[model samples]
Target chain A: MTLLTIVLLAVITFTTRYLFLHPSLPVKLGPKMVSFLNFSAPAVLTAIWVPIIFVHEGELNVNPLNPFVLSATIAVIISAKTKNIYWTVGVSLAVFVAMKFFL
Target chain B: MLTKKQATIKMIQKGIIDMLPLNLAVIPWGILCGSLAIQRDFTVLEALLMPMIVFAGAAQLVATELIAENAPLLTILFTVFIISSRHFLYGLALRQKLKVLPLKKRVALGFVLTDELFALSTDKKSLKGKLRLTYGVSAGFSFYFSWLFFNIVGIVAGAYLPDLTTLGLDFAIAVTFIALVIPTITSLPVLVAVCVSGVLSVVLKLMGWELDLVIASLVGMYSGYLTLRFTNQNQLNEPEK
Candidate 1:
């Protein structure tokens, strides 16, 4: 069952990716649509990350002591400043680990 | 002093070198995904094969989480499909440059076309024809290799190590998403879209929606689109006034 799911999922993903590769494909996205598509990455990623930080097991946990809030803030600052994924992940992971042990 | 063959090899090497910086970030995420797969009770072979076949970090992680929750197969497939739908935009943007390649090479390139690879290969001046193809191959394969290697290491480490989830390593997934998102919030539309989608996701989840992420993402994209349209209209009206 799992294998089937993976294969089916891969097929769907590959087909979507290959949608515009062929010239004969009739799908043409207008500039407005393209602009809309451009927001998909940020929108989807934010949606995924926000719940992970603010909600734990279906409950809101935005207190000061929530390790994720602090760690995510540090990660965002480092990522925004340095524009480097390595530093963002490293600093965030360290902060998270420290908070887990100490706080 | 380099022959023609050596020059081509040099181009490929440069492609790999260019991708090295991005791999620094990819490695940890790959490892985290691998460990999560083990925790989710995926077999060693299944975990190893996923990166090779799927090659999508965010989608693969989401799949593992869904599988662990015993979500329906259809739901898992749908979620991953939506998560990776952005690749279609990448493919469309690359169509002009890629049209010059033969069908076989185009298919090959399409299979491994990632965000990093697309960004690196899209430059018209630096890469052309055979060089572009070679660059794509080299960049794609190196990423593939390291991604798989780190995943294997993570699986092994997860097996021997205590519960990694307790260590808050799972939060690394969220961190990865943060790293991906923060760099892209440069404009008002994007900012509004992100905030709207994020808030909607939390609200929908609180309301016990089945697919809150997917719905929130679509609404967010639409909201961003509307904002872009409104801003463009305002700019046009200012020119007349």
Candidate 2:
């Protein structure tokens, strides 16, 4: 069952990726669809991270002392300011480690 | 100016080198995910093959967590599909730019398409010509191997260190996601979309919705689209100053 699930995962992911890129496929998207897709990446990413950052051990943890919140706050600011992944990740990880140590 | 072959080589090299920083960032999560999978009773071979085949760190992470809970196979597969469906948008975004390449190359490129590769290859300056294909594929291959390598290290180390999860290294995944998503909120509509989706996801999770992630994302996309249209309508309605 596990092996089957793993193989199916690969197939599903590859199909999602390959559908539009297939040279002979008749997949034509409208401009509105393209514009809407422009938001999917950010929206999907946000949805994924929010649960991890906000929920700890099945409870909501929104306090500043929460290491996830502090690190993510700094990460957001740095990512927006520098638009650099290295800085955003480096400093955020540093803050996360520091928070874990003190609190 | 360089010859065609020279340009191709240079672009491929650039792809490999350009992915170095992200590859580094991906290492911790990749290792952690490998360890998590192994801890979830995945055989060493299964842990290694998961990353190599799925090539999606985030989706694999989600899938493993569900597997740990002894979730149903259909549920796990559904969650992974929803998590990875974002790649559909990536394929659509790049199809035009990549259509110039032959069908075989296009298929290969699609197979390896990743968030990092999409970001790297879609930079405004490089979004042209066959060079994009060369660079995209090379970058994807580079990141893909690095991910698999990191997973191997994680699997080996996880075998000995049963408490790898206690180190709080999982926070790195959440933080990495923050860094990845923040820079992409380039406009007000995107901002609106992100906030709506994020808050809605939390709400749905709290309510114990079965497919909160998928539902939240669709709502978020719709909110963003509506915001864009609203902003445009406002501009059109405003009289010339």
Every candidate's fraction of true contacts kept comes to 0.65, 0.67
Root-mean-square deviation of Cα positions for candidate 2 versus the true structure, in angstroms: 3.3
lDDT of each: 0.76, 0.80
Model 2 ranges off by over 4 Å: B62-76, B121-127, B166-168, B238-241
User: Which model scores highest in DockQ?
Assistant: 2
* lDDT for each residue of candidate 1 in B58-131, tens digit (9 for 90 to 100): 78888988988999987888888877776776676666566557788777777777766654553445336676
Model 1 misplacement above 4 A: A1-6, B1-22, B26-29, B32-44, B58-101, B113-139, B165-167, B208-211, B238-241
Candidate 2 C-alpha lDDT tens digits along B179-232: 777877878898999999999988988887766776887799889988988888
Error of 2 at A49 (Å): 2.5
Grade the docking of candidate 2.
Answer: medium
Cα lDDT tens digits for candidate 2, A2-100: 778889989988988888877677877677876776677778767778888887666788897788888888888898899887898899999888878
Candidate maximizing lDDT = 2
DockQ of each candidate relative to the true complex = 0.53, 0.61
Q: How good is the docking of model 2, as DockQ?
A: 0.61
